[model samples]
Target: ADVDYWSGCLAPDKLAARITPATQALVAANANGHPAAWNELRTLASQHGLLLIEDSSEAIGSTYRGRVVGSFGDCAILDFTQPGPLSCSQGALVLTDDIDLASKLRLLRNRRLSDRGSVVAGGLPVADAGIGELNAALGLAQWTRLDDILARRKAVEAHYLKVIQSFEGIKPPYVAPDVDEVHWFLSLVHLGTRFSRGSRDDIVDDLHTAGVEAAAYCLPLHRQARYFDNQRPSQDLWVTDKLADRALALPFHAHLDAEEVEFIVQTAKDASINVGAGSAIYL
Candidate 1:
């Protein structure tokens, strides 16, 4: 089972162009808390007789076309890990409508560890893929209060957006017409095309020096060592490459208040100036 890389968001046309005879599934992620175009992706997958797997790991509470993200696809997934809305420290979930598939998932999840008595939460064997009772309890606690959690997170998002206006070169976040709600996984900003990847790195370094946690965002898998493709330079992935070079991820969590958000944005603005792309120039 090999995977084919589609350059950016799972736009139906771009993804369809890459499907081969061997393609058996379509995995589309609601990235950065914003839901992808699930309606289009589902149609594309069905047209090709391929299964649709919704990756809602980064978009737990987000909605697309008035429906929650996890409700799309033949099967869907939600990850409970650090920084997620329903974070249980480390664990995930597989949700499916097909009873047969649900049974299969449950069986496979504990097949290797079922005999181990130490594996709790039923006599069932627990594998690395299975969440223990403790984590499950924690995730459930958060899950039951998901509405309040998402609401608080939305408050934080509002703070960031209010302050984002003062930060030059960064526009208001974009939401497609079809998307109903967005609960971002992180506070990400894109610097203008004037900045190089190295300059973006420098800004991150500057943030670190000032004791502000920040990071670069969306490094294309094709350019990394694990899946390095020298031919990527000649591919139709200019948007991907350009985005990888200029994107930045700032510290974001529900606990953050308006003042903290201002400081973080101001720190980024200063960092940009240090990298020669002044605040007035590019983000």
Candidate 2:
């Protein structure tokens, strides 16, 4: 699950709490190519004797410490969703050096109910059609085009950064120093305390009215009614909570042209102005 940036009207800090060594299973957010954060998290997991599981669905081409994100943890999982480089329809992959975990996953995801031997062959079998042929074809095609796709996505993100950075009140997501490649899935703009003009909702609506689809990004998971009821929170997250309130995701795709990017930027700036001091805003 994704970490929530906000809870109870407060911004949560990006730093997770230091757990005792008794903790066994560790799950981490995939910060694209941010080596320091990853390094800190890796050390924490190592200290705790925990198996770090990275949700690398958003970091396909990102690197950490000169190694790719998928290689960072004990196990990493990737999703072939719409924004993913490997997307065709839907797919998931798990990567690990641990042979035991790999073998277990294979059996769990693709096991047959029918017995391997003659004595226990009475149960019904579960069959996956696409897992055999369609999945293989999709995988091969995506693998072949992975590099080119990543480059295209990077170009789009660079365009977004160039345009958005020129605007007065929007800050793009941070990219750490050592990240060699980032397979951008979304173009995020943070409206922090510095932005005096408008709220995130206002900006999102303004973009939408101009035919640019935009949205507030992640909500803090801790504040969700279902999750909060069951688990007591351990720390105060000042940064993440603020991010949940102010972060906006603009439309980004490899197919978008420079003209389109310009339009988005112009619209966003206009929206920011409109929302300042209640000038005018549909949202």
**Cα-based TM-score, every candidate:** 0.87, 0.81
Tens digits of per-residue lDDT for model 2, 1-283: 2243321111112323545445677777564323224566677667667888877877778776678877877998887767667775766788899998876676656544564554443233433322446776887797898888788877877788778777665444565555565666677666646443246787787788888898877667777888688985635554555566776777877788778888888888788777654323121
For model 1, residues 70-187, the per-residue Cα lDDT tens digits are 8998899999997888888888889899998898788767654545655445544434477888989999998999989888889988998988887777545877778888888888
C-alpha root-mean-square deviation, each candidate: 4.6, 5.4
lDDT for model 1 comes to 0.79
- Which 10 residues in a row give candidate 2 its minimum summed lDDT? 6-15
Winning model by TM-score: 1
